[model samples]
Target: MNITSTLVTCVDNWLQNLYTKMYSHHTETYENTVEVHVQETSSPLTKTLVLRILINEEHKQVHIPNIFIPLNFHRQGIGFGLIKEILKVANVYRYELFIVDMTPSFYDRLLNRNAQPAGYDAVRIDTTTRL
Candidate 1:
């Protein structure tokens, strides 16, 4: 929860290690990892997230797991905007899209054609009931 941008490269590497361990430990290829992204928060570090992903050539979008923000940080639109910005950037590199199977505002209508629910991926954008 660094209330700032989490380097995608760092996240990718961390996830790789996490996935490998989980697969080997359980004798299965299912697992998740904790992810932290820095954004503007009231304090220093805020909430955190856990993510999981399974790559498929048909899709190209990465999965974002549960995203959360501290109660204080939830007041501002930073969390929502942060998620929007993340999606905007990551969605581009995809030729098709391998987004986690979930519902998002952008995926609601306009971008639905370009994005699809991910079956083996996950991420959540933290938002409080206040927002």
Candidate 2:
């Protein structure tokens, strides 16, 4: 299978476990879901997950709850590419984007960088929010 499908399979398994753990104590059923987006290399031989982001869409808001990039992929432009893609979609749909649980240092680094991608300035960090 391609890297995207592989990543989705892996994430689905992880999410199942997470759901069980999170709702084990609750007697009521809850729908815990998020859209998973993966960024990976095009090469089949060296296919790697550059980044994975979870988006929770609600009403007119889009919440990015998690973004994971392997240590080896750090410093690459993959994160910016993913964010740009999300921004395009959000703009098209007129949705507000909120990044949740991002570290201040990371946010600072992204903003402080001189060569930020287009729409980088539009990103809003919601450190106190959870989705």
Residue pairs in clash, model 2: none
Q: What is the lDDT of residue 89 in candidate 2?
A: 56
Can you give the TM-score per candidate against the true fold?
A: 0.37, 0.46
lDDT of 2 by residue, 6-125 (tens): 334444444343234231211111232334433233335433332334434455555555566545555665455455555545555566555555566665565554322224333453
Q: Which TM-score value belongs to model 1?
A: 0.37
Estimate the overall C-alpha local distance difference test score of candidate 2: 0.43
> What TM-score, to 2 decimals, does candidate 2 have?
0.46
Which candidate number maximizes TM-score?
2
RMSD of each: 12.1, 12.8
Off by over 4 Å in 1: 1-34, 37-58, 95-131
| lDDT per residue (tens digit) for residues 1-131 in model 1 | 22112324434443343334231211112232224433233443531343333333344434543444444444565544445545544444432213345455533532333333334242332222111
What is each predicted model's overall lDDT from 0 to 1? 0.36, 0.43
Report the number of the highest-lDDT candidate: 2
Model 2 residue runs over 4 Å out of place are 1-32, 35-58, 111-131
